[model samples]
Target: MTHSQKHIIGLVFYPGMTSLDIVGPQQVFSALPGVQIHRIWKTLDPIKTDDGMIVLPDTTFENCPSLDVVCIGGGLKQQAIVDDPEVLEFFQKQGKTAKFITSVCGGSEFLAKAGLLEGYRAATHWAMRQQLMSHLGVEVGTERVVVDRNRITGGGVTAGIDFGLTIASILYGEDTAKIIQLLLEYNPAPPFDAGSPEKAGSELVNKAMLFIQEMSDLELASSVA
Candidate 1:
């Protein structure tokens, strides 16, 4: 699928952005020919991820060309994305003309914060599902991947690959995406089958509660509200 004008897909990164949130889905999108991927930021300075991955922006917020899709990666810095009204405004702008707009984990929450999910069914990692619904009034679901109109979403980090494939299929065709999947050998298996809440038992669920203690009280309160 070659368009004379490159279809640009932009991602916003900041301190603590999830590495997998950007890379996992990125591989899938980059696999497509003629689709350009860009690291977009408020500035052109070097950026870092939550897990110590250093990245350079391909473009800045003011200089970026029209986006075919704009996805915001999510992690601990999701609060920052939520706080930046300018970033949300950019999403709303690109989203209006973008052929498809989507997110992976808490990225869905960013989309909601941008006021782009109004009256649209969206999905995010189950952990942020409550916050997305509470702050943005958008319903969240537990699907591993979701496609409600032009908006696409997936569960946490692990679901990004699936999310990307679904987006590719929507853009090109099932044939194109399936071939790419086969080339990439996307068939996945896990040592443990406890990836999602449905697959995990109470013990795993309980252990996860311990990690929640690390999050700020504000996020927890908003999430629980």
Candidate 2:
């Protein structure tokens, strides 16, 4: 197959976003030749990550050019963005023309809030999966990476790497993706088998659920106040 001339991949950056969510994929996509990665936001100011690290935005919503792929990464402040009209409008506008609409972790909530994930199978952090289904009414998949047409999503935090590889394969080719993977030493052998709810058992799952619920409740309360 003939390659596309060039591809532009835009990643939505916002305050309190998960740094790894953006960095993981950013590293992968930016490694490929002829692929331009844009860190976009409402402004070109530095945005704080959930872990308190600050990242500077490379492009503003108004200044960003048309993109081939639009990716939104999740973070603690997802609810704030979900409720932002400007952010949602930006997504809606980009979704209309972008070749692929994707997200990682709670970023799927942003896409769903923008009305782009309707009737599409998407993935998000397992902790937020149930809330996403109940609140946004989108089909949530539990897989590490779920691709429905051009709407792709990654589960939880570290899944961003997997999501990146998937997008790489689509943009370039399987060989290119494999080479990138090798360069990154993308091999996993966890010390424990408690990564998922099934493997971690109900005790761990319930604890995590409670923590997520508490955070959500606090965010809602703050929003209402």
Candidate 3:
């Protein structure tokens, strides 16, 4: 594809977003051919993630081009952006024409809040599923990756990789996506089998929830500090 013909993909950036949620998908998309990726935010200023990693925005909400794909990564700070009219309006506008509107982890909450996923079935971090249903009345999916029409969503943080590969297959082809997978050596051999609540059991799930709550508390404190 020519420079002008490259697919424009915008990844929304915000304070306290889970880095893996963005990075996993970004890595997959970055290796694809004829694609331009933009780290978009309300401004070009640097923002700190939930883990204190500083990320710089390459484009702003007002300056971003019409995107073929628009995605967001979820974090504790995602709740803050849900109510921001600027962000919601931006999504509302871009979403009208974007070929794919997607999110990872808690990012679906942002889209739901923007009134973009009202009739769509989406996936999000399992922990946040109830909140989405209760607060936003979103139809939640139990899969690691959910695709309803042009709206795609990934479960939790690490699921972003699977989500990206799914998009790649749709955009390019299964063969091309397989090639990218091989090039990235995207083989999984996780030592533990506790990736999901069903396998992790009640005790481990409870512990994980506590840890997540602690992280949320820290994020809240940092946001106000």
What would you estimate as the lDDT of candidate 2?
0.90
Best by lDDT: 3
For candidate 3, write residues 19-104 as lDDT tens digits. Answer: 99999999999878899999999999999887789999999998899999999989877777778899889899999999999999
lDDT digits (tens) for residues 66-164 of candidate 1: 888778767865675676877877887888788778888888887887777887887788778878888679988788788888888778997888888
Q: Lowest summed lDDT over 10 consecutive residues: which window, candidate 2? A: 1-10
What TM-score would every model get versus the actual structure? 0.89, 0.93, 0.94
Local distance difference test scores for all models: 0.79, 0.90, 0.90
Each prediction's total of clashing residue pairs, residues at least 3 apart in sequence or on different chains, is 0, 0, 0
Angstrom error of the Cα, residue 209, model 3: value is 1.3
What lDDT does candidate 3 reach at residue 206? 99
Candidate 1: segments with Cα more than 4 A from true spot: 1-6, 215-225
Candidate 2's error at 57, in angstroms? 0.4
* Superposition error at 82 for model 2 (Å): 1.3
